[model samples]
Target: MTLMLCSVAAAASAHAGELPRLRTEDGRHALLVDGKPYLMLGAQVHNSSNYPSVLPQVWPVMQALSANTIEIPVAWEQFEPTEGRFDYSWVDTLLAQARKNDMRVVLLWFGSWKNGDSTYTPEWVKSDTKRFPRLQKRDGRPTTTLSPLGEATLAADRKAFVALMRHLREVDREHTVIMVQVENEIGSHGVARDYSPAAERLFAQQVPEDIRRASGKQSGTWAEVFGKEADQAFAAWTYARFVQEVAVAGKAEKNLPLYTNAAVFDATGTAMAAQVASGGPNWNVLPIWKTAAPALDLIGPDLYLPLEKTYLGLLDRYARPDNALFVPETSNAIWAVRFFWAALGRGAIGWAPFGMDATSYSNYPLGARKLDPATIEAFAAPYRLFRPIARDWAAIASKHPTWGTAKNSAGEDSTSMGSWKISVTYGRNNFDIPWPGMEPPPWAKEPVGGGVVAQLGPNEFLVAGQYSRFQFMPVDPAVNGQIMSAEEGTFIDGRWQASRRWNGDQISYGFNFNEQPALLRVKLSTY
Candidate 1:
């Protein structure tokens, strides 16, 4: 705080080894400085209101995590509240501070959308709906939507957004802000995807071939690609329409990496996501987003679902040759490895938990409205594990096209985690106990313990569960070829540090009943 923060013409990290020079190459995403694979261990502090002031205070926490990139939001309300008014001073403050801190920024436009709510609308247009417009529901009611039919909303959104892109272009072409999310959660709550008569008219019509050409399909209507899978009849048109309109505006500005976020829908049926929308995007309608927003590089997931099954489904949805998977928002704390592993195994470019900035987050559990404390504690473990491996993973993914496709280099399933493993089938196997616990349930068969596992480097990993004493064995020569150990610590004052060690053939940390998870920085030493 006392010293003048140095700035990178393109990007800079305050301290040596504080952050890495990051870039994505080919069709893969990785963080590299001169040219070595790096994984991006990042956190998104969705703090828009407290920009310049909070940035200096907030960045030290990120730098302590050894975080490579910082994902911050530049709200539309602040940037452009009026038709021609554009204020980028906050962005200037943000970038300059980030450069000083030696951190990179991934800007989120809290414009036309943010959790599907237009809460960021500026004072001028927000007060006047007649000139701006709102989307109508089936009952001819105004559904808290920025009218998809409103040209003023579109113009306001585009102008501010274009200004943002232009600013980032001139200031960030060095790619300091390596990528940008066009809008926060596009359809997390826009129910029925705008039933406005104008929206309806566009929805009923066949999708233009230009969209099809953009998406990569040679032929077929919206329903044809996704099928009336979920009223495929109207959704394809609506979702495509929404994506196309936004994408055109963004690409029309700058081609810097662009993406949109979607909330996950129920996998059981094609029914609209009950908590949010009827016509909003689910897994089935991605092709339309791809086609309609060709210039838009990816349609990311804003995951809140706790179930691992749904995460696998979501990963399959966004993981594509052309589309790299990145989660803009996900559950704060939970056994999120199922999702993280899925993203890495399937070649996701980037991922982060939303609202990570506030310490109050620890007390809130999930989002402002949702509380799932166990889920939060479960996920907080991985945040530390990623610090050392962040750049390495990204570099590997970028260098290795097969990076995302290879679920396991050594054959581990992507979905397994420690806490769930103990509850799942641990008491059933005959394998001897490494940690404490006599197994569970009278119906329990043998002695087997299952926990969560993540491979950071060749042999290095972080593994934990309902507390375990793992007796590891080598099945292959590679497994036996290296000396292994891990650093055990939690995020204390923003840095990942080791409190103790679990030495010898097998090491263990954490108690069996606390519900708290232990993370290890597994070091696989070749020398």
Candidate 2:
């Protein structure tokens, strides 16, 4: 039983609040602390939840990200393998260490969902099929599911969770665990929806109007919920109900935030349609889940898509005022730099690139393939000062997505990472500020500061690295601050180039530049 104090002196000194809340400011949503928007720049460690021994090594990575909170899972099998046997040493240790690091956390309940399977069921429940129901495949063979209707299984899960929640109230009533994910990537596989006897009976009955009405959905039977495929949405609705029950039990004791993560396939009506109609958190069924799981506060998407534009676009679609923008997981790549910058600039609550382990070999998802040396360098730039960099950047990203967003030209006419499918765009000269640098891994360039850095106003910004200077030029008098002179350049793709240089170092005083990253010290005054 240790304390987890998650705040930096610069940010924490002014705020006095027990817990954090999400808020909207200047047209962006940010996590509010002490009634002010707080940014969360974080990363998801690789298998950090299952292995405590890896913590020492894994924690370093989390520290590097400057993460305000960690998303860790407590599996049912690991905690209570045998019927009533419950062990919390791993979690306790994690909590204690989190306190040591002054970090906050969001716990994922690995009860019935972890990648859409009951793989973490305790041995008692795993072995005893009589008490726990299983999902059925199209052919009627049992699919993976702990009977949504199983009295014993649900009772066991509820009790274990309630106990866990009660203990949290006793030990962490201070709100160390700000939020809890009801389950991880909850959705059925190899099966559209549960077709078990109990599940089947529930589906056959009349539609739960509370659900239909909540959705304002054109309703009839499961068949009419959509058209011909309403049954799938119906089945997903039923499973949601199951998860909602477990969530209700845990949230009853402590009123901390609660949410669920959806393993996104695509945004086109078709992709999400399958998950929804087949018993997933499709947008349509959102109204359904809202009704069923009133206790759950948010629903998020875990993205690993190669399509950068589309992937981020999906995040934008789901990121609503009622639903905060939280990217639970993503692949670690160079573009992540831009994405992270954009997400923060847009007011994202959290952003994590998966595989936060020490394994240098790299184990990102399939969609995250094709990392050239340049991309590697781009990603490396932050790792040199992970925690400091992430924290500093995350503060702005989480609080002001619009703030972190800046449009600068590439330094060279053309620059491409060796194997990357993408390119860095810049103006002309390959200067550090305006130009996207040649791939320099975070591990390569030693960082001197504690947190990450980014530009804010014209010439104003906070730095996490030491003794580094960047170059830039004035474009729109509105954003470009006062410069010594003009430096003509154009960005090809993602790289930049400086063709001509004008003498402005004489007048580059702190006039026009207010909070810009590149124009630090040099003022960008309004002409």
Candidate 3:
């Protein structure tokens, strides 16, 4: 612990005036904290579970889960209950609790929108429908979503967000709060888009030049330019512009990385887009949001998709050089751990499961409820392993190419990274003294193995995985590859403490890892 503290101190000392910022290198992105790249092992609380009394439940569970950051809501209703007055007791309390627990925070601002509903808005704003109107449907029915076209609505949200940022700057100069989520799953719901007069007027005009440039269209009305998808595109433009204004205001107060999360379009596409939140950064509308909201740092998707390919595809879509991949909210299911490796392989800065406290919501998904003991154990595995090598992992992730694979029924999988073709097999003891057979453990029958391989050099690799074995072969036929050294170790106090030199039978077949995550440094040579 003392050495860890010294390492942290050294990092802070190295960069005297640099504020917390995001850096991109070698086509990958990382969040630099206190002059060192940090990976966020995060868990979020329920929407209504961030008050002082409820927070006690939050810390214990997060600590048990080994989360380094807590994502919780700071609602507009709670922050400013009345019109012109603000209360920051909630924010102060959260900072104090996070400091005590040695955790960082990604404060989710539930201002104008939370899950496509304005239920978290202040009472004053909600009551004045004329001044701050709700989004009107095509048939003259008003939805619960706030109209992004309203000047009063945007102004009020911008004011409140700026106030919160100003307060954070005054009280949190050390940056206990690392990032701020501008809103929660923001978009229009229950309708494709607003049918109000203002929205209709904007839709009727020539598609804004910037939006046209972003979406690769030119000089046409929404209907003419986008055809059937124009409604959702128009809505995305207005909503992103509104959020962008709020973001610009808050950044003016204190510049910190700000992002928004999308309620991704499911497989049903048209129906889902019509009924669910279709605007804000959904894959199809991502270009519109990016062009309209220049103030936003990144846009990430909430992982609610049921299929693995769909989930992985979304990771590929958003994991672009221009944007950083962050799963700010996800399920707590045991199988979800594989996506953590997937995200890391794509150079994501963070991964977090939503609703992690000792509380439950009626309408929530099964894996998104309060944590049970088993769930905590499931989450703790990856977090405990990553927390130690967080700095190293972030540094390596930005500049090096990496690959990850989930176990197959055959208990083996292979992928290419750099000049090596890496083969991974899942099983138990590899040593002949313990078990002389090639057969795997009973658990190997299940999808219980997965790992990430990062190429540190042409023949040198950093391998971390659970319940798996690794064997690397050179891609160049003329060169024969053989492992020169394989040292299994733990990163303690910023130094690798080798536990056992893996040789003899261990290296004869392959390097084996148990259920616990094992970090190894392997060097290869050509003959």
Candidate 4:
């Protein structure tokens, strides 16, 4: 993956010549923007924070967080307030703000579905249920969820999305908007699948041929084909098909990468998967979505589960040979940084924390809504540390093996990747300089330190971590190796700018990585 920078004046030229594309190398994925490999150190604004007035706060918070890109909504109701008369003012403002701030934008389309509810639909559509009906529960009662079976709703959403793409082409000649999320957490909340008359008729009929072929099943009805999982599978196919139509229409206007994010359901039964948000592309139903929605460039997970296993498990599941890994939304908790590194190690194209501003709006996940200074720093630390070297890292991270780990107080931790074994130790005193009778500092007790290591060559490595100790050794004991040189430096525009040489006591025991983040170029020799 190469990094290509589009000049400010003729940004349209880059898109015209070669638009942003997702490529896979050695079963890993990379997103190339303007022809260059790009890493998105991103943050997502609150659902209602994309308004003109609220965006003032959003930009400052993005700057404070040191984010290179932001995810903001372009609501259907806001864009098409009336029936046909469209307003591009909000989108125009968002693009302008992003350009002024020198940041990229991922526009989320809150059309038809926003967190399992059609509340964001235009008032005109919501008022007339007959024209644009809502999903029905098993009892035949209308729920807030939009009915994907409704042609009116699908047509309205497709028209609005296509308009957005067309307008984006006109104004975003610089290609400031890199990607578009088709819808927000699409699915039914109270029910597994819509029980509307149209939905029932289709469900009772033979299961779709494409879905059966994709799942490798013989001809059968929905219930007979999927048995106990019939309802969820039925809903997934309908929802995916609906999103594909909207995405196809938009891509026709401006062919940018398009994806939809799922409100993740636990594969383990520790949490109820049905209650989480059914009908969307949950892990189990991912194949159905893939076969049904071929137009979708990718399917991402909005990981809000706070558990370590769950977060890492989502990364493992989504980073498949066919699908690229991208976390479009997650909480703003300090622990999120650890998952960021984990995602990188797993070859994720990008990851962003949801509701990253200092303010809160509505009842969107508390961890994401209200941001504290510590939380901002927790996320910003990596972004600021990686900004200069991000392009180079993105180019090489997927090709070469990489590994990451958080500070584990339980005991010593280590990760072996490529040709080196990296041993990580917690709560270490200042060993960079000799201090007789010195004790470990207070910050060492519960220090927040984790990092990512990417092998650049057989004997050369790139290392960055904070608040821990890193010792590099040969993975194979038979390969006698010693550290040849360790230069603490920074990458300025893909060039190495070394400032300090580590010898004598500095790297005698191991690198005493502290709160201050630093990038290191280490070389080793096998004797």
Number of backbone collisions per candidate, in order?
34, 81, 0, 4
Question: Model 3: which residue pairs collide?
Answer: none
Candidate 4's C-alpha lDDT? 0.81
Model 3: residues with Cα > 4 Å off, grouped in runs = 1-9, 265-271, 360-370, 407-412, 426-442, 445-448, 477-479
How far in Å is the alpha carbon of 22 misplaced in model 1? Answer: 11
In order, what lDDT does every prediction score?
0.55, 0.56, 0.82, 0.81
Q: Write the per-residue lDDT of candidate 3 for residues 1-527, one digit (tens) a residue.
A: 32643475477667744567788776789898878778899898888996998987789989998899899999999999998799999999999989999999999999999999999999999899999998999988888889989899999999999999999999998798889999888877668888998788888999988889889986799999999888888888989999999999999988889999987746335556646786768888889999999899899888865466667778888898889989998877666766777778778899998778886552245363445687678778878989878876876787688787666556667888777888887665566355455665666665456788778777788788877788888888788988899888866656667887788877887878776788888899888
By TM-score, who's the top model here? Answer: 3
How much does candidate 4 score in TM-score?
A: 0.92
Error of 1 at 387 (Å): 3.4
Name the best candidate (by lDDT).
3
lDDT of 4 by residue, 1-527 (tens): 11232232134335453667787878877887876677888899888887888887788889988898899999999999998989998888888888899998999999999998898989999999999988888889998877999998999999999999999887787788888999999878768888878889999999888899988878999999988888888888999999999998999999999999988857455224455578888887888999989888889998876666677778788988888888999887765676786787777788998887655553334363447777788888888887766666777775777777666546367887667788987777756456788787665665266777878777888788877788988888988879898999876555577899888887887877776777888898876
What residue runs in model 4 are displaced by over 4 Å at the alpha carbon?
1-17, 216-219, 265-271, 360-369, 408-412, 430-447
lDDT of 1 by residue, 1-527 (tens): 00111122122243333222334456555434423444445567855534676665466556554556678888877887666889989888878877787776677878776767778878787788787777676777886667655777777777778888878767754456766777666553545555677766666566577655655554654556435442343544454455566667766666556677777756555565534644445565666566555666667777776655566677776766666667767665543433554566566666776655533444244543432443334444544555544544444345442212111222233232221221122222233346577654342331112244445444555444432233333444353424365566643322346777656533432212112335555554432
What is the lDDT, from 0 to 100, of the residue 253 in candidate 2?
A: 77
lDDT of 4 at 91: 89
Task: Indicate whether candidate 2 or candidate 4 has the larger TM-score.
Answer: 4
> For model 3, how big is the CA root-mean-square deviation?
3.2
lDDT of 2 by residue, 323-358 (tens): 777777777664455455445534567766766555
Report the CA-based lDDT of candidate 3 relative to the real structure.
0.82
